[model samples]
Target: MFWASVGFVGCILISLGSNIVRKTVERILTAQVIIMWFILLICVFTLTSMNDWIKFFKSLVENFGKIPPDISWWTLASAVCFIGAGGISNIWYTFWIRDAGFGMGSLIGKIPGWRGKKTSIKLSGYLPKPTKENMRRVKSWISNLHKAFWLVFFLMNFLAISLFAVLSNVVLHRRNLVPSGFEIAVVQAEIFQSVAGRFGYFIFLFMIAMLLWGTQLSICEGIVRQLADTTYLVSRKVRKFVKRDIRKWYFYLFILFAVWGMVWIVLQEFFSELIKPDFFLFLSANIGLISQLISLVMLLYFQYFIARKYLPKRLWDIYKPHPIRTVILLLTACFWGYFVGMAWMEKLGLLS
Candidate 1:
């Protein structure tokens, strides 16, 4: 609970800080790097020796194909869902928090005194009353933090998503004795192939599409989009993002990304029935777990820095860390970090 609160405040601040000039450039460069790497990955995946690649896939299929499907599906679904929303929903989430409020102590202190205070962008009630100095410092720190974190955020995203996609695809393959690989493909290709096929899958997926566009998804996306874009709104280079999506291009980008997710589903369908499927499922679980651990670590670091800079001297004395609390924090960090690191090393085939 303590950590979660701290993390939330950190995310809100990072979202706010994106207003700085340097951070603006940093985030832009980071995006370009990710796009470049993905392009390179397309080339590599395309140019690789098919014969050798197929042979490797064949061996993987044979080995993992041994696992039972009952377990792998759960892991694969959760992992991809976790990492797939990384870069996109992350930005959206910031707005949700901002909308709620900032300056935790102030907010909490006010709650007991007032039963009916509400906040909005137009109202200014939700925002903390900013002093001249804090505003200047926050604006500066946030600018730098915005760029720094987003760069990390984007780059980490590439690593996280690549981990997720590959892991989930691999997990689905070796699920059973029944050749799910080609069978699933046939099922999908059937959807576009003929009438019965079209209704069988297309209608079903379309119905699923209704759910995709329904209230729950909308609420979730709303919160996430608002949060993620918060940083951009605060940044000096905010105009760049606005220019890119002037008619609110981000909303369109959100739709495009959602549709592209179908591509991931298709790829999984093609490979799900292969051998050694457990290999990928295990990877997915490990990756999701690791990603969460990274979130924990980053949030902690982000909060530590913010407290140092923002908290008042009197407030700091009141909130001073006790010796036992300090030890607990250190131990918790070490424990999660160790496990995630272990899983990562295992993924590289480095463990005994």
Candidate 2:
């Protein structure tokens, strides 16, 4: 508990410090390059041969969508949502990309630090005029976005997950070892230790620590940005309070978030017995179901209705929505909707 609190505070400080400059977040993420490389190396070395990977992929294909009898359907659904930004947390990418200065996001400024020279910011952004030069720039931006999405997001995460799956099959599956809770990570480290001795174990531990630290920092920053944006848009009181100084609202909300997290941690530590493990599982499942359903509707509506209604016709030719993505979103929404209905029926003893 002590170590967890200390780690939490340290990551919060990193998030706070990142607000100092618009590019500080990028720099902090860049620093993780070494750790990420280490993780990749460890995972790659553990797998060792192509046969190991081929067998893993074969088993995955064989067991695709076959849920274990012991595991609840809700648990599987939530796990899917938790993996690879599957919930409304996927919206965090919007804020991150804006902060990265993509498209019109370059015009709308970032969250300012408490102690920095404030940058001029606007609540809204502009559409680039559909001149030939501007059209060319938009084309280039779209191209770059596609490349980055595939290379940085899809490929990296796909490889990482695949490697981890292979590691589990090679190391734990044969031994009939299934790790849960805090031991999930510790047991996984045996994969590395089997290959590289005691050093591998510590390196694996460090990699896990770094990954969790990065995840927490990004979540904190993203949620603060999201809440700040939502409040500023909806509440006249918040808009009046912040006036032009949006930084004040952002920092205040961040502080409140930090306080709430700390309070929750304290409660978890001192009154642990009162917080049933199943409560967390239930909460996560509901979050996944609710967010997945709501966000899918909003995404489809914005893509088909809002964009066409609001965007300039000239830009429309250049900013066409992907039909495949729209179809996938609808399918995913239907899936979660059905899952949620079934879960509720089960709880009501109707499904039995």
**Looking at candidate 1, what is the lDDT of residue 107?**
41
Worst 10 residues of 1 by lDDT: 109-118
Task: List, residue by residue over 1-352, the lDDT tens digit for candidate 1.
Answer: 2332343333333323343212332354455445545543443353334554465567667876353445433344344334534322444435433433433323421110011222112212233335566556555544654575566665666664543334234323333323352354344334323434444445434433332233224333454355324533465354354452312333343444444444444555577666244555466556555555566567556546765467665444434445675676577557545655655655566765
Per-residue lDDT of candidate 2, residues 252-273 (tens digit): 8877887777777788888889
Best by lDDT: 2
Cα RMSD to native, each candidate?
18.1, 2.4
How do the predictions measure up, each by TM-score? 0.38, 0.90
- Candidates' C-alpha lDDT: 0.43, 0.74
